[model samples]
Target: MNAGTTAERVYDSLKRTLANGSFAPGARLEPARLAQELSSSATPIRDALNRLAGERLIEMRPSDGFHIPRLNEIGLRDLYRWNEVLARTALRMSRKSEPTGGHHIAPIDAADLFGFIAASSGSGEIVSQVASANARLAYVRHVESSIIEDTADEIGDIATAFWQRSISTRMLIQQYHKSRLAIVPTIIELIFQDTQTIR
Candidate 1:
């Protein structure tokens, strides 16, 4: 077991840890240490780090090594803003003859819901970046779960419209995204506070 494991397997495991925020932003991702923890060798860990870097979840420094991307106000805003644009494009594209039904959606989970929309965007880059950003936002979403829950209805309506092919309601999707901007300011402040306490 010394040679230890597959790169793809290591990548998946490390990605889960990163997505769950087990490793805070800017935390060094030393392959040797990670390999030791995973009961493997550094080779797979290095491979995993490269894959994570491709998704923008980790940064590879020139002289240093891999580290999680640092979270900040600018980065947080960029994540939401980009998610909005990408998700909007995806929803519009994924829009076909919507299924007819009164199926109810679960309460709002911005990270997850928007991740779904972005997944349909038909663009690999868009999907990858959005997923990475959502992973970063998962921790914040957990902390501010209540403040964001108010979006449940609006988001549900948007999802319902998408499902039912209701043109009238479908147009409301843009408004849903625009309305989300209002919370960005507060989110910015919260992320700033949260990152400050990280170290």
Candidate 2:
């Protein structure tokens, strides 16, 4: 394989691991070990790790190597809130426009959405795939009308800006996963809420 393909593989492998929770928050990423695991040289591993660091998925330390970044409770809440608003806004905008002939909005399955986003973004095939994933997830939540408890209703108007255009179905899927990352903390909080309510 070419260098570019190798780098892409390395990047995809790392991202998949992160998304699947195989590597927990603050887990160390040893370049040597990663290279061995991926059957690649350290160069590509370093490159992939660096890219992940830039995405805020991993932390880079001068002397301590790389670790996954942790999302605190407050940060996680904000993430979920931001996505909810953005997604709703995008859905509203999509409704306003006339659907072109042959244009279809399919009901997106959760597993498919995750797989699409992982492949699209990790492969570096298209930048918009990330945004598309976000939209799809939002659509799912909106369709279910499940109010994400404990999230702020004060969604900023900026979300509407992202919704004004006709984003590809693929990008909508990507956006879904990206937004899912934000509300991870809320999911944990919900478990506690359930426990308290039950008692």
Q: Quote the lDDT for 122 in model 1.
A: 59
| Best candidate (score: lDDT) | 1
lDDT of 1 by residue, 90-192 (tens): 7676634322223445535666566656655556776777777778766656555546665667767766665665675446756755554667667656655
lDDT of 2 by residue, 89-176 (tens): 3343343433322343332434233333233223342323433333323323332224443222212112222233335442553454
TM-score of each: 0.72, 0.52
Residue 155 lDDT in model 1? Answer: 66
Residue pairs clashing in model 1 are none
Each model's lDDT = 0.67, 0.52
| Quality of model 2 by C-alpha lDDT | 0.52
Q: Tell me the deviation in Å of residue 113 in model 1.
A: 2.2
Q: After superposing candidate 1, which stretches have Cα over 4 Å from the reference?
A: 1-5, 62-64, 95-108, 119-129, 143-146, 151-154, 168-180
Using TM-score as the measure, the top candidate is 1
